[model samples]
Target: MSAWIRMIADEDADDTLQEVLNLARTPHGTVDNVMRVHSLRPSTMKGHVILYRAALHDDANTIPMWLQETISAYVSILNDCDYSLANHWKNAAHLIGDEDRAARIGRALHDRDPAAVFEGAELALMRYAEKLTVNPGQMEESDVTALREAGLDDGQILEANQIVGYFNYVNRLLNGLGVSTAGDVVGYYAKAEG
Candidate 1:
């Protein structure tokens, strides 16, 4: 819940906000608390969803979905946003399908040691994400050069950058608004339907 305004869920959303609520629904059917916070401005919420889908879900993206989730979780960790961290960690764990591997990734991100969990292109990407999150101004052409050397073309590198930037923006938004992670997003939808 945010300290600024009351959380607006489906039940409480008015006509104008309902569209945003619908667009914000997760696969399980409930709207995310992050989206509820954005419900303060329906149009912004709509545009946010569109941008999110395009940045993270566009079919043409060469970056693997699991890698995108990993980038998001890593950025969330750097931003110290437990809300986004928990949600993205769940997505990453599910996509990765190995608890042990996921735990290693978590530990690596928490310890700020990407080498412990990744290598080759993955390691390069993680390092780039850390740099982008911690020192965006210091980012140089050399960083992009390294990713290219790791086999990512310009488009993939751009998508990776966008994903990192998106999560940073979202983590700050949720953290600034005092948003809490709603446990089991799917469970929220189930409970609401029941």
Candidate 2:
């Protein structure tokens, strides 16, 4: 929980808030502090879950779950958001299931050297994520061009863009609210949800 604001615990939640909380709850029956912080407004909590599902969990999304998590981890890294970086990196690592590859991914993100771990479209999208997180204002059409040249279609590029944007938004939200990852089970997600 954030030290700056009050969060409604699961036991204290009203029916409506409880319902929204369920959408974001882990399989282990705990809600991350990031989602719990929205307890005051159940709608926003629902909105967060919906947006998260669409951005990172929707079946319609073409980006693989592991790569999506990678993009999220990378964005979190650039934002210096420990909560998201730790959680998302764990997600990426869990999905990858290769400790050495996951370590390489982590190191490359930390070093801001996507080329070290990714090639072709993956590399291009990672570079785009880094740029968007660090210098969004400096982005130009040429960045899109580079992604296309690297073999990413417009749809995949948009998927990457949405992921990057979503993480940036949530990173600021978590940081702004002083949310902590103390009780969260990193990398956990409901099998049926995102």
Candidate 3:
């Protein structure tokens, strides 16, 4: 599906926008549809890329990258975001080193019961992601307490919140804008399988 807004083509991009596009390219040598959709507002796209990298990739955070991807995948599933779900589930499977296990986790998360696939702190974190995604207004201190009890300190909980919030925002943005998954993103998962 085409986006509601026009994406700036590479050849037509201005110098600043070209730099942003260059930075937005995935390792597979293509920019994501999410980034391209944001080309209408280059600065927002730049800020989004920066925030996404920091939230998910900053080495200072103790949260494992695989877990982050799992949280993102869970959130996307809960939100019914096909684009993000496919992208993150692929990443999660790659990180966990077993596509079957990741697929099982995805199925469990889709059923709103990841207990079948996770345990202890991981389960706690998944529950937190669910509450934060489904009913942010109902969140209580007890929610934070659950994470703490599961061995996540304040910093790690904060990181988890940021990741969940970011994915929710992006999912809504893409879904609201009718942003279809890019061809390369589909190819990303296909390449992973082979």
- Residue-level lDDT of model 3, residues 1-194, one tens digit each, is 25888888888999999999998887776788888889988899999999888887788878988899899999999898988887888888888888788778878988999999889899999999999999999999999999999999999999999999999999998899988875545524455222
Compared with the true structure, model 1 gives a TM-score of 0.91
Pick by lDDT: 1 or 3, better one: 3
Model 2 TM-score is: 0.92
lDDT for 114 (candidate 1): 86
Compare candidates 1 and 3 on TM-score and give the better one: 3
Query: How many residue pairs clash (N, CA or C atoms closer than 3 angstroms) in each of the candidate models, in the order given?
Result: 0, 0, 0
| Model 3 lDDT-worst window of ten | 185-194
TM-score for each of the candidates: 0.91, 0.92, 0.92
Model 2 per-residue lDDT tens digits across residues 109-192: 899898988998899889899999899999999999999999878888888888998999999999898888876776664243
- Judged by lDDT against the true structure, how good is candidate 3? 0.87
Clashing pairs in 2: none
lDDT of 1 at 7: 71
Alpha carbon lDDT at 39, candidate 1: 78
Model 1 residue 164 lDDT score:
92
Quick one: ranking by TM-score, best first?
A: 3, 2, 1
